[model samples]
Target: MKRKKWMSTLLLVLGFVLYFSVNEPESAYAMHIMEGFLPMGWAIFWWVAFIPFFVLGLRALRKITKETPELKIMLGLAGAFTFVLSALKIPSVTGSSSHPTGTGLGAVMFGPLPMSVLGSIVLLFQAVLLAHGGLTTLGANAFSMALAGPVVGYYVYRWMMNASGKQKLAIFTAAALADLSTYVVTSLQLALAFPAEQGGIAASFLKFGGIFAITQIPLAISEGLLTVLIWNWLQSYSTNELALLQRQMKGVKES
Candidate 1:
């Protein structure tokens, strides 16, 4: 009952954010804050911002491992999945491209702890190797994409699954919601970091979220459908692997 309530609240919050984000403006920061949007001092300030959250996530992971061995493997796999998936960019606009973040699927299957850790790793690599994000903005990026995305995704997925008997429908709904929610959270972060004089927080979010929605909504839906298909396929063709994965997670938690 408590979990259900929490999920409901999360969905409501996500929905509200999405509604606002749909009207936000367009900027490179719409997808991610660039290398120099914030000055070095400010960027460094935000970069280290995720330290506390990372520590909390690590502690959560240790607690989770007490009950499951599979958690460690899942974390590793999630990191790998994010790394590989993000490395493959698909053309969005003429010169621009985007990739599936995969934080949603990770959170749904392995909980938010692992997903945060995994996402951080992937983002770090992307920043260093591909210059996809930014070194100074690492903290902001990690918090928005890694921590917030997965946590929201996990709760949303759980909520939808519990509400529906149809597994496929639940998975699809969760995936779409999670993807959309991640973008909304990103917009909120941008709004906070780069406040507008006239519009304030609400105005900033509206500007960034609106433009981001154009690119993100379709991508999110595609990601959601792919995730559902993959999950359903795994359930049917590779229950043994899924069982093993779950068992390993349980062992990681226990250990």
Candidate 2:
């Protein structure tokens, strides 16, 4: 796809998501950290930590789109998958809602680097247009859902695939763990920012994590199954694209 066309497509998706956010009737506390919720030090730290990966991701994105322009559609699909899945929020314990990170499918398909860019873009626009997450906390949210989730998901798929040669299992585990990893990292972020007086960060992490576990575990599993279905659809319907993708992602193979 042409660069201009890609930008237009992205904007179109952005518009749809904004409309969904604005017209939605129910409001629940966001699982995403709100604006100005984190301390300045922590917020800046996350931004600093997240920037290097995003920079590397930009390079990777450019290389892929320039090299094998066909995957542009696949790229857009991955981003849209994330936007759709993550936009779904279910009420949960505490003040926040639980939802799938939806990074695993893309991470498994395109690897983690490019996904960092896509996932971060999702978080950025959500923060700006939806007010779902805050600009100050975007770094933290992006780090958790984008960088950390995709890394865990991608590697888990690689490891599972290599070890067992089971594609379905690999995809499921990657998606589930990827979904879980976002919440885990987010829990850690909350714990770090607000450590328990008696138990400190570790104690607080367990507490924060415990709160999210109620909803996140089931949501993760559901996301995993849903991703497997999507993977199957692609495998059956887009054989040529999968073949091209296999070539693009070195070391990926069907077992």
Q: State the local distance difference test value for candidate 1.
A: 0.66
Error of 1 at 73 (Å): 4.8
Minimal lDDT window, size 10, model 2: 16-25
Residue lDDT tens for model 2, 33-65: 889989999999999999999999999899888
RMSD of each: 9.8, 6.8
Residue 207 deviation, candidate 1, in Å? 1.3
Instruction: Give candidate 2's whole-model lDDT.
Output: 0.86
Tens-digit lDDT track for model 1 on 31-63? 556566766765676657777778777886776
lDDT at 49 for candidate 1?
Answer: 75
Angstrom error at residue 148, model 2 = 0.3
